[model samples]
Target: MILLKKVLLAFFGLCAGGVIAAGVYAFLAIIGVFVRLMGKTGTRKHIFLYETVIILGGVIGNIMDIYEFPIAIGGFTGHLLLGICGLSVGIFVGCLVMSLAETLKALPTISRRIHLAVGLQYLILALAAGKMTGSLLYFWQKMASLG
Candidate 1:
């Protein structure tokens, strides 16, 4: 019985990990495509609008996951809250970076450098958000196992 439970937990963990990874990848890919599309127009307003939507989406997704899943496991609530907080911070930072980059456009070279940095920062944040969601799923599974 114990072995079976361990096996099930392991299986679920992998599933959760895969789900998170895939979701994050898809989200990033979509954002990248949107940014590229906006870049074609070469307008600061469009870029800002795109960034706003992406940040809003990220926040909404995290909130949805927290509400959708059962948060009965140890530390699950705290983790979820922290994840939400982190997502908010990330969004703010991403927007700030983008705004700064837009302002630096006159110095073409600096703008490119800032854009890369901002992109990387957002990627890291998105990955972290995905990881938190995965952890929440794993915790849910473990809690379910107890019953």
Candidate 2:
């Protein structure tokens, strides 16, 4: 029956979505994002709030992204909001990358293999600068091409 097929499809889709969500949450937990924040802040009192915001933000962000929602906050306030969002996203991504590298011991292994000593901090700074430069160049080229 047509109704039965639709129901089955919908059920499978929901199950798949649930599985993906669980995997994403597990990844975040394994990366210790929340734990890092708690450790840096020296407070666990707002852990619930932090967790709630992360969950809601993920859901709302996905919904907005999928639906192509237009957030029409124009002018200076909009620019400020955009800047804040950009900085937050950049920081989150930097933290995620560093944590993943640490988990894999990639940087340490590389440094050791290269016999790098007394310049690890400079190497990190150089890597960060290179990433920033590359990101800016990529976006610049994309914008130029668009225009």
**Which segments of model 1 are wrong by more than 4 Å?**
1-74, 110-147
- Candidate 1 least-lDDT 10 residues: 98-107
Per-model TM-score versus the true fold? 0.27, 0.77
Error of 2 at 103 (Å): 1.0
Clashes of 1: 0
| TM-score: model 1 vs. ground truth | 0.27
Candidate 1 overall lDDT versus native: 0.63
User: After superposition, which runs of candidate 2 have C-alpha atoms over 4 Å from their true positions?
Assistant: 1-8, 73-82, 141-147
Which tens-of-lDDT digit does each residue in 1-147 have in candidate 1?
999999999899767866885696475554454554456667657767776777687666766765696646446676568568666666555544444454555335643656764466565567667966886687668656854
* Per-prediction CA RMSD (Å): 17.5, 2.9
lDDT, candidate 2, equals: 0.81
Error of 2 at 97 (Å): 1.0
